[model samples]
Target: MNQYPLWKNLLILGVVLFGILFALPNVFSQDPSIEVSAARGHEVTEATPDEVRAVLQNVGVPFKAVEPLAEDKVLVRFPSSGDQLRGQEAIEAHLADRYNSALTLVADLPGWLRAIDAQPMYLGLDLRGGIQVLIDVDMEAALEQGLERYTGDIRSLLRQEKIRYLTVMNDANRVTVKFGDAETLDKGRKLIDREFRELEFETASDGKNFDLYARLAPAEEEQLRDFALQQNITTLRNRVNALGVAEPIVQRQGERRIVVQLPGAQDPARLKEILGATATLEFRLVDTEGSVQDAVEGRVPVSSRLYYDREGRPVLLKRSVIVTGDQITNATSGFDQNSGTPAVFVNLDSRGARRMREVTTENVGKPMAVVFIENRTVTEMVDGEPVKRQVRTEEVISVANIREPFGRRFQTSGLDSSEEAHNLALFLRAGALAAPIQIVEERTIGPSLGQENIDQGVKSVVYGLAAVLIFMGLYYRIFGLVADLVLLTNLVLIVAILSLLQATLTLPGIAGIVLTMGMAVDANVLIFERIREELRNGSSPQASINAGYGKALSTIVDANITTLIAAVILFSFGTGPVKGFAVTLSVGIFTSMFTAILGSRAVVNLIYGGRRLSKLAI
Candidate 1:
């Protein structure tokens, strides 16, 4: 009755072996290294290794090896974290302003193992060194910008339809188009109702002016805000990916706030530079009929504006924008056909492509300009005091004549270098932020502190496991040894599942593991006690063993199911560390039940199932 079928035995053995294979990678740990990725144009080629070696040699910084990675990246491995830091600084100093370098911990597993794509579970910011930033998005500014765009759209619509309008103005939250007569206002309202379904238009007569007011409905406003937040999150994720940060976290914290955690991020300032800046591109016609000198001398035309280029030369541009950066679906950096100089190739979305075709068809051979706009924040010391300031810069990056009525794909030249072209392409491809974000809080965790936390967490788990093993072994005798083996197997299965899933492990996750260790043997304890009761009742040894597991199964299932429900709830409603704890706890509960009930039974049956005895070991 205690014998397990051959298939059952094989299944258990297979699971154990599978767990061992996945869990073995963790034993190799990670090595201190510096990850080098191109900031913009330069690719990481085979020559990069030699350059890195030369730099290290020049600076007297020792390194183990420099290896090229995928996606134009490279890794410089060092003997220790100290050497990693020193070598990174040396390389940065030598390269000057060429690449973006960050200190990272990479797995030192054998190449054969990596060939199969086996990797260790990622560690979170709390467990590894990184930067955590809290950003608050400006929703009011977003709304105002949306209203301004609406006003511009209404102005263009009226002009296109040849409808007479006195003025179109955007105030705090609404756009008002005033007509000279009520008839014109009615025509404008009908046109808006047919074209713009997202806006609610109302007409009114204020004695002399017949005005049509347009505003977003309450539901539309709410949707716009949500869309802005989500769009910013997506944009930030793209920017972080371009930075080549491994396992970065960019998630919405609340309605208007976002939380960003970059694992193994060494330079917070550089991160802020990328995350905080709002970069976008706009195309408009160059106003050749207007005088730039007159505009610069404060005689600006109403339909045109004056802007400076990268070299501080003023130019006149039409006030209307042809297309914005958000309309760009793709961008790539390559050499121009005729000049062979570096340039950016851009592809527009369907609507943008149509608009481009229309505009170019109307104004062929006229000069057009691509304007690059960036808003950034600078912090500096002023009169021995820390001060923060916001700065906005707009410059024309490219100017070319529209050769024909082409759309969908176009190229922009006149960039300073290939690096600038690459950087611009990356920015355009990432899309523009719907709203600006301000960094309200920033925190950095040093690698040494992270290592200390890891050590303490490991010690806690080891001590807890040792205590549990000793208690179970002493209390249950031979049967207890079987339980101890199952407990170890449970730990392995939990780790293997975690590694296979590639879940991030945090410090709180360690606590969950320690708790799991204590809880793993509960089912075994119940089974052992039930068997003892059966023995006291004078049942046969085999019968008692069979009855113990049968009677204890329900209790084990009931206890674990209830706790699993709690873990699921925690995972659903929790954030960050709490969620991390819940994940491990949930996984542990399942693994423990399998190992304690089924695995232990398989082992016991193989050992004591074949024959009867006068006395049992237990």
Candidate 2:
């Protein structure tokens, strides 16, 4: 009755082998290293590694090897994480600004194993040290910006409709449009009412001028704030990805707060800079007729602004912007074809293109300058407390005559080096933050602490598994040994599946694995108990074996399916470590059922199937 089919035996054998193969990568240790990638217009040649090696030697930082990698990259391997960090500092200090260096952990797996594309499971923040940041979004500033846009839109709308307005200005999150006549104000209000239904409007008369005041509705305000938070999360994700960090977490926390976690991030200062700075671009007329000396002496023209280029030379630029970074649809960094110098190719959206076309058509021979603007917070310690102050910088990055009037597509050159071009491309490619953000809380987890967590988690899993194996072997004898053996396979299958799925393993996830170890054999215990009951009822050994699996199958399926549903719910609704726990438990539930039911049965069948016995191992 318990005779096995050929297909069943083959299937079980295949699963064991497959599980072993994919799970093999976890056994190999990862080497601490630094990856150095060249910026635009640079290459990592054969001598690149030697130069880095020489720099390390001069700095007295020991290194195992300096090897070249694919894609204009080089890897500097270190025997210790300490040495890796020291080497990173030394290399970054010695190398030119064009090279981007990132600390990484690379596995030294065998070529054959890697040939099959097998990889280890990702470790979460608890297992890999990194940084976690809590940021507060500036919703008021976002609202003010929205109002500013509304003011501009109102002015443009009036101009398009040939309705004249005295002034359209945004003040304290409200846009007020003043008109010289009530007829024009009525027309503007009707136009605004039709176009911007989301704004709450009010009207009043001031002396001879008529005014229309507007602000966002409550629902619209909430939605705008939510959108800013979401956009910042996406932008932060892109920036972290550009930094080459692995498995970084950027998620919305509360209403106005965002939680950012970067796993395996070593350079927190660089990370802070990337996360905090709001870098953008603007294209404006160079004011060829305006005097730079007059602007420098604080006699700046009403239509112009004084700014310095990358070389710190004063330049006069029109205050009216033709285009901004927000309109850029795509940007890429490379060498310009004609000059062979570093440049950023830019493409604009329809609105920006229209603006660009109008500006270039009107001022064909005039020079247009590309201004790089950055807003950041500088922290200073005063009275033993840190105080943050906002700072804004605008520098002209490039300037060239509007040659033949181009719209939508253009390239900006004049960067000092390829690094600047690459960074500009990175900023443009990653959309700008919708509003300013304040880093309210920050914490860095060291790799050593992560190692301690891993060590403790593994030790607990080992002890729990060993205890279960010992109990089953002593109690159930032959069947117990089979259960114990299959239980071990169940663990392997779980790891293999987790590795195959590339799920992140966390400390709580390890707890889930331990829970699975105890629960994996529940079905086996049920079947074995049922078999003993059948034997007491005077059934034949073969008949009892079949009846045990057959009678317990319904209970097993019912129990496991219910647990699976709960795990799915947890996975869907949970976040962070809770999600990690759910993932491991979910995978373990399936593998546990496979090993306990099919795997144990196959072993038992191989030993005793199609045999006539007076007594059973039980």
Candidate 3:
């Protein structure tokens, strides 16, 4: 009654072999290596390896091998961490102008295994060292910008409604419109109140000038701040993706803070540079009418502004901007067709396009400058003490004569390097933050802690498995041995499944695997107990073997189904580590059920099925 078909036996054998093959990759260890990548406008040629070798030799740092990697990168493997660190430092210091180097871990898997795509599971942030950045969003700036927008809107509204206003300006987080008389003030107040529902209007008159003030409601301000926070979070996510970071955690921390955790990130300086950058571009007409020396002497024309280029050359540009980065719909980096110089191609929205067309049509053959503006913090010595200062620097990156009236598209050349072009394009494509953000705190996780976590997690699984195996082997003799064997297969199946899916295993995921070991054998215990009961009630060996599996099927299914539901729920609602735990737990449930019931039954049938035995070894 228990004899299995040939197809069933082959299927079982195939699965066992498949599990072993895919799970073999985890046995390989990683080597400490230095990754070298070319800095902007540089290429990693075959000579890169020789240059790295020579640098290491000169610095007295030992390296096992040096090889070129994909995407214009190089990898230098070292036998020890000391060698890796020393080599990385030497390479970075020596080649800082042309290349960037960092210490990273390279897996030592064989070529054949990699060829077949047999890969190990990715570890999460808790198990792999990464960087955590806490950024403070400037909510007050967002509110001020909102008020400025209201000022512009009110100016347009007054002109359209023929209600002449003397002045409209934003100050103290409020838009104040100055009117000549009470009649004009009353008309503007009614117009603003009818159109802008989110603003509260108040009026004051100092004998002659009538001043009308409008401020955002408290609820509206709160919503605006929340929107800024969310927008920054999305922007950070896009920037992280551009950096090629894997499995990043970007979430809102508080009312005006964002938390970004990038797993497996090694370059802290680059991360800081990109995430803290508030770079934008503005197009303005070169002010040929304004004298440069007069502008430098602080007698500048009211319609012109002074800025410096990358080479420290001063340029005069019109104060009115034709278009800004906010209007850019897309930006990409490439080489110019004719000049072969690095360039950034830009696309603008409809509104910006219309403005560009109007201005270029009017000022054809005139020079237009692309101005790059960035806000940053600098430390300078003041009275023999270092003081931090917030600075806004503007520079002219490109200036070209407009040949024809064009709209919606343009290209900017004259970048210092291809790297700068790429970074500028990346920032523009990712979209600017709603308001400014400052990195208030940063922490870099070391690989040593990640190693400790991995060691402890492995030990937990090993120790748990050993204790269960010993107990099962001693409790029920022959059947206990069968359960122990299937438990091992179940473990292999779990590893294989996780590897195949390439899931990230966190510290909590390790805990789930350990807990699953105990749960894995619970089904075997139930089946063994049912078999023992059948034997005591006078059933023969074959009959009890069949009866044990058949009757316990319902109980095992019901139990696993309930636990699986819980895991699914956790996976749906949880984030980060909780999600990792749920994934491993859910995978374990399926693998354990397969090995406990179908696998163990197949083995039992081979040993005791279709046999004549008067007694059982239980």
Q: Which one wins on TM-score?
A: 3
Compute the lDDT of residue 27 as modeled in candidate 1.
Answer: 86
Q: Which stretches of model 2 miss by more than 4 angstroms?
A: 37-48, 55-61, 88-102, 134-144, 166-227, 237-247, 252-257, 264-432, 437-444
lDDT, each prediction: 0.82, 0.82, 0.83
Candidates 2 and 3 compared: the better one by TM-score is 3
Give the deviation of candidate 2 from the true structure as CA RMSD: 5.6
TM-score of each: 0.75, 0.77, 0.80
Alpha carbon lDDT at 460, candidate 2: 99
lDDT per residue as tens, model 1, 224-247: 789889988998889887887655
| Model 2 weakest lDDT span, ten residues long | 379-388
Clash pairs (backbone) in predicted model 2: none
Give per-residue CA lDDT, model 2, range 171-256, as digits (tens).
66798888888887888899989999999999998668698999899999998898889888888888888887655778988889
- Residue 469 error for model 3, in Å? 0.8
Q: What's the residue-level lDDT of 65 in candidate 3?
A: 93
Kindly list the per-residue Cα lDDT of model 3 for residues 35-152, writing each as its tens digit.
7876534778889999999999998998889998876788888987778777866876677657766556667899999899898877767876667878888898888766755675
Q: Which parts of model 1 are misplaced by more than 4 Å?
A: 134-144, 160-162, 166-231, 237-258, 264-300, 305-317, 322-431, 437-444
